[model samples]
Target: MNDVYRIIVNHSQLISFWDFAEQPGQEAVAKGPFPYRLTEMAGPIERVEDGPFGAAAQVKLGQWWNLPRHACPELNFHGKDAKLTVLAWLKRENIPNRGCEAIAGIWNETEKKRQYCMFVNLNIWDSADQVCGHVSAVGGPTPGYKYCMTSAIGSTPIVKEEWHCVAFTYDGQYAKVYLDGVLDEREDFNPYLYDSGLFDGGDDGANFTVAAVHRSNEMGNFYTGAIGGLAVFKEALGEDELAELCKITV
Candidate 1:
């Protein structure tokens, strides 16, 4: 068993780039006694290459910068009445005119439906631009009936070619989105949407992927950019914690 930290008074739960660098393996920090493990679809390091933004870096599952195509790479956690959070640094080099999704949650794939366990996607269908967030309880409500919440990230294009930190937190009923540590959006999901079924867990022959979803369109198949400093937590971080997480300096 890994060393688990208990929630105590004045306990500082903070993770930094230095912490990530120091830990060579994927299962670096075991925050609590929760039944979860942080697994890297790809390793911690990747390379940056020349792109639309002069020079750029890429991070993919397993080795970084390959763009996870399918539901193969993910961080798996198992427990009831649990909260979860995921954090990542993204630098978009090429924002496709077409639709694309930058995922940051649990993903489940089945023969019938492709569920983004939790996600924040850039919707670019029919010239409509939107930044939407969603979470799904696998096999719930006949599949694909998961709860979703969305808000416009920016009125204009958000392609400044700089790194940004995106974080997501869930308290079972509600989910919140954060940009560079600031609360961008919050959603209260309908329980009935998930009443039909619960997540099949990681054992239902389902796998999760990060950064991108499974399907692709003519517009683009992968996200062209540099991604780094991804982290996951088991509980919904409180307001103070959220504030601290937002302070990440990339």
Candidate 2:
């Protein structure tokens, strides 16, 4: 057993897990301690070889997965001041457009609110014209998702047809995005500027969707790529460890 993950916290610190390894031919399944499931499949998230962790899953234009609401208790954060980390192995050889390429998120799109997310930006409306990672720690239960964002710190074209480890961290103090284990962008969290609740666990009625954010009624913003070993950790990882995490087992 991995003793590193056994730290007692009144609840399982590692909440969501989907390896796409043990389960083959099946459409969706949740292999974690919590009852979290990739129960919702918009398209066909096919299983492929040479996964980032063990085995990997791939998605195309309309392909996606989702976790039913309140299934992610770790997102709530409770009284814990530790950082929240999202790490995934991505291989996007093709992109539909220069809009928003969402990796994964704790978002409730129907209400136009997102708790937190890591995405690829083409700098459409902004001056920056590079393809970069966009990380956000958003606060909501209101009109739109209010957030402090950290963006743009890597090369363009976003690495095609290759396995790259992408990560984002929210340590209560700052938000940082990592590409291939390198810290690319960093921004501080602004709480005083917003007059809403900061961390309130999450919505019980919400759902965790992968590869798809359900951006509009047509269900656009779908990520056309492959992802392996998507995991959420309660604690933020150091730079060295983040680099090490990106290393694939050969």
Candidate 3:
């Protein structure tokens, strides 16, 4: 096993991990406990061999991966003390829309079932081309805003067509965004504070999605790029551990 995959699997709080090594006509299988599969949606995604983790999946506009909410119960993080982590290795690409790009999580703005999501260039608070960790306790837009404004945004813009490690962690009190395993500090944005906790979407929650999010009554905010790997943990990961993961190669 490679060091990257080994370290992720060894993490005690790991909920799911996907190396994006699946072949055509196969689902994106996940490792760790609750190893659910992500079915391709909208259209077929191309699998490329050149990747850091292993084979990578290239998702274009209108393409994404999906898993039903009922099947992945462990991913439904909620309550006042809810802690979570989401990590991804991606090669960014410029999309036609030039809007915010959604990486992963259970954020469905269409039905007001927003829990948590990892996004890039969120275009809020004067942010552009930066990693963003969005958290919502109300499962909807932040009060008095058209969209959720509570998020931890990194200062560094993720360059296009480069392999980068992006991650987010929420430890009940703060939401933090990491770029290439380092905390890309920003004034009051890198570690956004919100102590209210996550929202429990209950029986009618949004499905876990990758590369896109439901908004404006449809799936938008698509991330057009190559994804080498993705992982989720129930507990927030420390800086040292995330840095170690970023150091590993294929």
Candidate 4:
């Protein structure tokens, strides 16, 4: 592991990572003192050249992957009083079909439920030209569930076909989103803890899929575009550090 990762993991909670640099025919590879490997599941999700971090993964035509949740509970942030940060490079090929489209998420294993999610909210009808999204979570008890809290970005039209760095962070109170290395949006949510419960997933966290959420696993809601790279930090990165990361290019 590098000195930077050691420092980041020191204070953060759950950090899922994928660089899409797996060697040909290899069983997926992840970074860290505790390595977590992922398996490519559905089709059309291929490896390609050029990415912010390195080799990139192409997600289009309903393709995605199943990631094994990283080992060590400290690396899992789907629970309460969590400090979560997700950073990734996105290149949208076109406006995905109307309605909510998920970028990635872990929902209740039983189905039709959610724990935490990061996604772009599109219109239901194909005519609306607005662009927006949210980073949401289902906190507290189940029946008495806190109804899902969200942090959204407004009128940003993030569906364009160009590489853009996106980052989302939730530190137990407010949800902040950064786009292209700049703070794009920020929303304050009712403070509470996230409960992973049955949806905490299993073994390397392979039970969950990427480019889409466990809830909308089936259908055309999966993201249709390219993911240059992805990383999760247990703790929200300092603005200066995050800005430095955004300076990296393909």
lDDT of 3 by residue, 120-140 (tens): 989998899999999999988
- The residue-level lDDT of candidate 4 at 217 comes to 40
- lDDT of candidate 2 over 1-250, digit per residue (tens): 2221222112244556667664544645544555466754653456788765556777767777766655556555422354667777788845446567777766544554555556665343242322333333343333343333344333433566777777766665555667777766423221112222223334453456677675555565667777876767676666787776665621
**What is the alpha-carbon RMSD of candidate 4 to the true structure?**
5.5
lDDT of each: 0.41, 0.56, 0.89, 0.53
The TM-score obtained by model 1 is: 0.57
Clashing pairs in 3: none
Better of 1 and 3 by lDDT: 3
Per-prediction TM-score? 0.57, 0.73, 0.97, 0.71
TM-score: model 2 vs. ground truth: 0.73
In terms of lDDT, the poorest run of 10 residues in model 1 is 1-10
Displacement of the residue 71 alpha carbon in candidate 2, Å? 2.7
| Model 1: per-residue Cα lDDT over 1-250, one tens digit each | 1111122112343321212222333443323322233344445544454322222235433231222223222244333343556655666655544344554444433232333343334542221222333444442333233322222232223343666666666566555556665665323321112222224354443344445543422112344456544556645566566556545443
Model 2 regions lying over 4 Å from their true place: 1-13, 22-35, 77-82, 95-98, 122-157, 185-205
Q: Which ten residues in a row have the lowest lDDT in candidate 4?
A: 189-198
Q: Stretches of candidate 3 above 4 Å error?
A: 94-97
lDDT score, candidate 4: 0.53
Inter-residue clash pairs, candidate 2: 67-208, 69-206, 76-201, 93-161
